[model samples]
Target: MKRKLVIGDIHGGFKALIQVLDRAKVSVDDQLIFLGDYVDGWSQSSDIIQFLIELSEKQNCIFIKGNHDAWCEDWLSLGGTPSVWLSNGGQKTIESYDNYSDEELERHLEFFQRMKNYYVDDQNRLFIHAGYSSMHGPEKEVYSSNYRWDRTLWETAVSMDKKLSKNSELYPKRLLLFKEIFIGHTPTIELGSKEPLNKANIWNLDTGAAYTGALSIMDIDTKEFWQSDPLPALYPDENGRNVW
Candidate 1:
């Protein structure tokens, strides 16, 4: 059987996400894996969450929690300005949920809470929202903080050495157990560069959709990729303001 189709950070651009999935022609039997960041940096967080929930019900949808999703919940808890979300294209997401009842909000929170930290298939295709720490073993260790909040780990993964020292607190060897790993967090210069150092093993798929970059999806078995044109223009005119 073919491996599942994995997608990079969505950042709440539902229109582009739908287009990419349609282009991929994902079927009911095919597995779909999301690398996280389902909300924030786009206007469709609410719709995207609802759509993903529906998708999960109909098909095998594996979701990993992203940094932005963590921030959204935190912001909501503090009654903070979703402005950060809005500036990053979250206004539309808020608009989408304008009619949602309190119960629906609870359901959304529940779904977010239930999202996995990582996914490992039978083939050893590991999927993590952000890169894993080198120190921990392969038993799915949980971090006290959200994966996105760990800037040190992110910077270390993208450092000049590329390899986090085995002795370092956050080592990559722990994840060496997997034949191959797929992740999203740090954005790459291009979709699939061959340079191991330049090409993050994490398989960054975010593609900066909110910043005029393409939205991407990869077929795990074939390593084939599909992308939508950059949608950077979508944010400026949103709500007739420079909110994003």
Candidate 2:
């Protein structure tokens, strides 16, 4: 049976990414929807992007751009390295690219350029790297960066009163725009959960692979998930975006 798998933030943990995909028995028949942040943490940021480019050729993929990805793209194309980004893992991403040739970097840049801000499927499910503030949905968002940086959507869902029905006037308008929303960027570890979190039809898949938590992947339909070993264990010699 074909599965639609949604992946969380990678943060350059390519080994973990590979482990979970194998553990899940992912195949060409599966549709992989990546909730970005593919770079900026562990040692293989550049390699992860390269692998994704190759993987997309053999399987269906939808890559949603994340804030980290956006920053990386800017550095790659404009040659401006933001200190904030560097402090947050961009430095490691830069180090990871030291061995790549200019031509290869260009290819990787193109890959980043092609990533989507958000994707809405035929079933009305939304796959985005982060949340959007628009009550009308992501398409009508005035500040496009919110698509890759907003946390209010997740915050609203998780903090809503459980007794409130969707039909209630007090219900959040943004939640009504989609059947379901899948996002990455805010790690679930912050909420004290090491697994995928579902609140008010929003699924947060980021389990903090960039720090100490494990990387995760989930079947949107089955809600079944697979996770890699904690990233620190996978790369004990390195600290992956642990500071901020």
Candidate 3:
């Protein structure tokens, strides 16, 4: 059978990412989908991007863009921030690319810009960086910015009636076409909480590995979920911080 695996927010933790992929034993034949946020949080955004590029070249992988990535690109356009990024694990990302030239940085940025916002398959499984916006009416368009940055819309959509919620002003009525939607944003308290409040059909995969959370992945067909051991502590520099 063809196996499809969806990985949650990476947050630049290449080490944890490798570990999880190894554990999952990702094969060239398997379909691997990254739920975005590959950069930021862990300090290896550059390395992570390079690794992802290599994966795209070698395996069946699809990349989605996350809010953090959008923020990082925007931040770079405004002016690269060593202090801000480093403070929130950007240091690791910088450290990963210390040897790269200006050309390499530009290439990485370009790759990030090209990422798609969502991936929908015939199995009724939908993958997006963040949840869909449920605030607008049926005719309202879903924008990329909403996919990456908006949380209120996600909350509202998941909490509202499934049928009615799909009619959200922020999301297109076409989205109701799917049977199930899988997403990775708002980190859950634990790997897989049973409570509806802690868990939604949305399937949040970010276990908060960079902040007392675990790196996670889920198999679409079997609904099997896996998580890496949590970090000993929040990266010391990322205390009470949010960016990256």
Candidate 4:
């Protein structure tokens, strides 16, 4: 059967993304979901977005909007770089497109603007960038931005009891609402892990591809995984984002 594959934060590690996907031997027939943070690290933010745009035409692809992506989109649209965003790896993204033409940059901006904040599949699996603070699902407008900027969702999951039956009323409403949840904002490294982590049915696939570890890709069904070399090895010449 064609597999459902989910990719973690890429953070401008274009070469790493290519490597892991190649290693996984991902075919166009397979369903691919990129959890976001495709830019703002390493030195290929523009290249990464371009690659995914072309890749989408060749395969089944779903893109999520990440906090970094949001900031980048705002910068691209406003034409002003904010210090806060720059400190959080936005400078690397701006540098990546230093030579791009107006049309090319426009395409990337469009791609960023069109990214999904969250997606719910037929299986009720939720795919988001950073996740939200609400336990009532993604419907509430108050916490909507949290879909791409929140970490409390994962933190709550990490603190919950995964052993609890899904049907149990005590189960976290967030997890209870979906068959599974996949996110990428908070790197696994933050959880003291260098690989993908599963807690309370929430899967954090980001393996610190922007800094400390490799890019990761996992089969959503079998839970099998593949990774690229450490991102530094892939972009040895460039100093990617150093901050969280």
Best by TM-score: 2
lDDT of each: 0.67, 0.94, 0.67, 0.87
Winner on lDDT (2 vs 3): 2
lDDT, residue 133, model 2: 93
Question: Candidate 4 — worst ten consecutive residues by lDDT sum?
Answer: 235-244
Candidate 1 ranges beyond 4 A from true positions = 1-3, 75-92, 138-142, 151-172, 190-200, 233-236, 239-244
Q: For model 2, state the Cα shift of residue 169 in Å.
A: 0.7
TM-score of each: 0.78, 0.99, 0.77, 0.95
Clashing pairs in 1: 41-88, 42-89, 43-93, 134-170, 134-171, 134-172, 135-171
Model 3 steric clash total: 10
Runs of candidate 4 with Cα error greater than 4 angstroms are 162-169
User: Model 2: which ten-residue window has the lowest total lDDT?
Assistant: 235-244
What does candidate 2's lDDT look like per residue over 86-186, in tens digits?
99999999999998899999999999999999999999999999899989889999999999999999999989999999989999999998899999999
lDDT (Cα, tens digit) per residue for candidate 3, span 1-244: 5689988887877777887788887788889988888876666668778888888888888888887777677654565665655566655655666798888778787877788888888776677776555434212435656676656535654565645544467444434555666677766644354211222345667666556566787777787767666543434454422522
The lDDT, on a scale of 0 to 1, for candidate 1 is 0.67
* Candidates sorted on lDDT, descending: 2, 4, 1, 3
- Predicted candidate 1 versus true structure: per-residue lDDT over 139-238, tens digit per residue: 5446645455443444544552656554575555544566666767666534343111123344556666655565788888777888865555555554
Minimum summed lDDT over a 10-residue window in model 3 is located at 191-200
Tens digits of lDDT, candidate 4, 1-244: 7999999999988889999999999998899999989988788888899999999889889999988898899988898788988987888888888898999888989998889988888889999988876667887638667888888888888888658787788877777778899999888887778899998888999999887788999999999999999888877787777834
Query: CA lDDT of 81 in candidate 4?
Result: 80
